[model samples]
Target: MYKIAPRISQLTVRQVEQFRSASAWVNPSRSRTESGPEASIDAEKLFINPEVQQLLVELTGMDLEGKVFRARRTTMQQRSHFALMTDERLSETMDKMRREAQRFLSFIPLKEPRSEEVTILSKDDDIKAFDNSKFVFTDITFDATDQDRTVVVREVDGTLRTATPEEHDRMNRVYYEKPNRPVFPPPVFKDPYLQDALARKEHEFVLDWACWFYEPDDPAYVNLVQCVCDRTVDNNDFEVLHSTRHFATLVFYLALNGNIPPLLNYFGGQGRIRDCANLVRLQKRLLPNWRFAISTSDTDLKIVTDFVKQNSRFHEALKDLIAFLKDGVILSRASPKVGSSFSAKAVPKVHISSLLISAFYS
Candidate 1:
């Protein structure tokens, strides 16, 4: 039924011991209120975006353009804000979204049915993976409506059943009782059924993470957060606590206010251009059509583009070769003659952001 038992836990006994001794491992950037420091990825400052201005006009027929943050709140204020985007039609505040998400989580149908509209949450995967005691998991809800449309999942041969009143109480504790919840740190299977049920559905509609999630207790919490992240075989990887928060942030923005944009599609943490060549082959196996992309940072961009551009020249038969991410980005492709097809083209990242805005507003 399985190739091997997945590592019992992402943390070995040694890793947990390391955290117990350290008073506090400082994040180099400082500004660590919680959830580690804020993400300093790319040109994320989109306050003065011309594209966003244009988008507001085209969609709302109003001059409602400027920094996306509320007029009352400052940019720094918005940095820690989880529900960063809003509209009257969608959630208007972080608390509102959290309530909606918690309500959704609390929903357990009276009768479970097996239909695409309903997902049987995977129930046999690693246990205790998502039992973190910080940050509410209520991030974003896709095309969410003012309805109580809840969801659940099950094992291959399991039956879906309704949650009793007591069961609901227990589930709430698991989902919301963060500070009070204790991680026994061992063979104790505190909540096996709950963890499996939360394993991302086979074709789950949304993959979200609590931007404010940071467990102060687990000293080595950062790595533990990454370990608990769901890596679905269906390609719905929720890699929060690291290099992929941008994807979730984008979803929060677009789906709530404007048309949902195509995801920037992370091809997993290929280690910041450490494996540019191998990335091409892996991406080919995963996603072939969405070939163009921006990597974690400019250093990553260089590693990938530099290799591909040089490889193109070695062919001798192929000349006038151009790399795709020269402007600072990384990409992978499969070419018959090139062996590992990769490219880079100088693009004003503003243009990349602009184009992404265009696609969504369109």
Candidate 2:
């Protein structure tokens, strides 16, 4: 006789919890029930993965060697302001970017959410009557918004707690089915299909759809996005991202995992030295104890040098980056300002990049 798998509903309480724990990757740092905008950073699944580190090294080498630098398909105001606008506009853009970056980096909460005590169901006579199955209850009131809907679950062991995002979504679909959301998750979110979509450069499409389909805090959403993000790093396909929205999120994810060297290399290769410095500033902001010497007066080039010298991770691609920075300095000095209104004779002394320095310092 062939062995058969037991149905999930028939599993014992401890067995069910074990299976859930095994299948779902929960962020231990946050509440399992709370929903929020920020996705959990799974360090083990990302930077700690051997494949990911190898890919980062490869991308850094390519970028530092000037082999992967190309004109971006889309324009980013903050990155393009130096060539596209007057000094005043450039300064304003940089200031806005700096404030935004600071806000994003400063909100790191190390404290996890406090777990709530379970409320026993009053309807259960002995409390052991329905111990064999988990019961879920949802607020079906007409005015209840899906996002604000109250969904709770009573586990097989008689423990009552707020339903997880996945469970909450399921309950919402059952009561108020949206035309776009399916009863079950789409197959595209898994395995070969996701890899195929990423390879085709449909990252933006996939991410947009994921935002629409799953709540920001949904485990499915988090997993899908991070998987896509890891692939982007692996392929060094930043250009395919097309806009600043997801790009900033990607940068934040990298910084969260202490992996910014490849991103630095990419910016340096693209001749965006200010962007490189901004990235280093972001790193320092995230890690307060970084102990790097930086000030408003320090050139962006110097800031990048500080990162390279202190972080041993930068050793592998150091020579190429240094050479690129040197060439950038020389080229900036020799070439006339391409789009600035200033006369050739009135051009200010050249820095490593056309980046506005004061904003990053702030």
Candidate 3:
């Protein structure tokens, strides 16, 4: 299958939230219903598969031991501040990245934002205005969320719980999902058609945050998401969408707020945070045909060109990053997510990715 193909960002607010809100609690080793308690091994189908883990490792060299490190490059502010060196600097770069990841794990596990970190765009006393005309708009500000969003949690004994008012405030303020994004179904299969499509034209990337549920061949059982996309961009070209079920990232701030817990998705939340971090990937790369973004506004391309032109080093670095991401997916297609053994290893500093770009994977 073509790892990355032409794409169009066009899913609605509810649609994106549905994926975020999807609660699949099935333990493959156990016979529990989606509602019952599951053993600590069933993956969320999209985010916990072996294929997904391998992809994460290849792309970021991540060990998937979320005890730390997703903090550095996953946030908007942190992302805008990153720059890569030539391969010659790879060692030094990796060293610096290791320190950052360690700090993320040892000192500051991604936590909820301080009161000073959040800025309310609207006045609290007066109103609530939203756009529902098209795309079920929930957030007007870029990457921001509706003021009244709530959070759900999986309790200690395997029962699902809605956060109390205090927890809700913290949850909503951090890694909250918004409707400003447009989603598209990209063709992820490595087939002659995709090869042909790419040979004809290169693809544009807009990295978006996502978590996969099933391996490539599994039916995946999430009929809600399937039905929604089938209505818009279904043509048996779902290479990207399927992989999304398993790729996880910091979904908001530079902190580890709502990121999907690797094992929770796999083991059904053994007192782990439901969604893991607060960093958002633009969730852009998850969407397709991002080149259209430049067509509508050259500003996007100009920003990239300017950044790339800063030096040959940066230009080359960007190219290498893209190539690595593209190659990672291609490599992953061959090692389906099924055979991975949940029993595993937790590691030291080396888990940091040589690529510090946003943990943004397609």
Top lDDT model: 2
lDDT at 94 for candidate 3? 77
When 1 and 2 are scored with lDDT, the better candidate is 2
lDDT ranking, best first: 2, 1, 3
Whole-model Cα lDDT per candidate? 0.28, 0.53, 0.27
lDDT of 1 by residue, 1-362 (tens): 12211221222334323333221222223221123322331112231234432322222211111211214323464444334444763545545644444333321111111111222222444543443332111212564221211222232344232232223223444444555343223221123532442342211211222112222222233332222332221222322211222222222222222111112123212122233333332222222232334354545434344333433323221121212221333343332121343454343332233332232223
For all predicted structures, in order, the TM-scores are 0.21, 0.56, 0.20
For 1-362, candidate 3 gives per-residue lDDT tens digits of 02211111222233333332212223122221222222232123334434443333232222322323323343364433566769869777777766665333221111111121111112222222232221111223465443334233333333333333334433443444334322222343223544443333211111221112111212221322222233212221212222231223221110111111221122111111111111111211221222213233333323333222332332332343233222321112221122322232222222224443232231
Q: At residue 167, what lDDT does model 2 achieve?
A: 80
Best by TM-score: 2
Single out the weakest 10-residue window by summed lDDT for candidate 2: 107-116
lDDT of 1: 0.28
Find the number of clashing residue pairs for candidate 2.
0
What are the runs in model 2 whose C-alpha is more than 4 Å off?
A: 1-135, 154-161, 317-320, 328-362
Least accurate 10 contiguous residues by lDDT in model 1: 107-116
Cα lDDT over the full model 3: 0.27
The deviation in Å at residue 179 for candidate 2 is 3.6
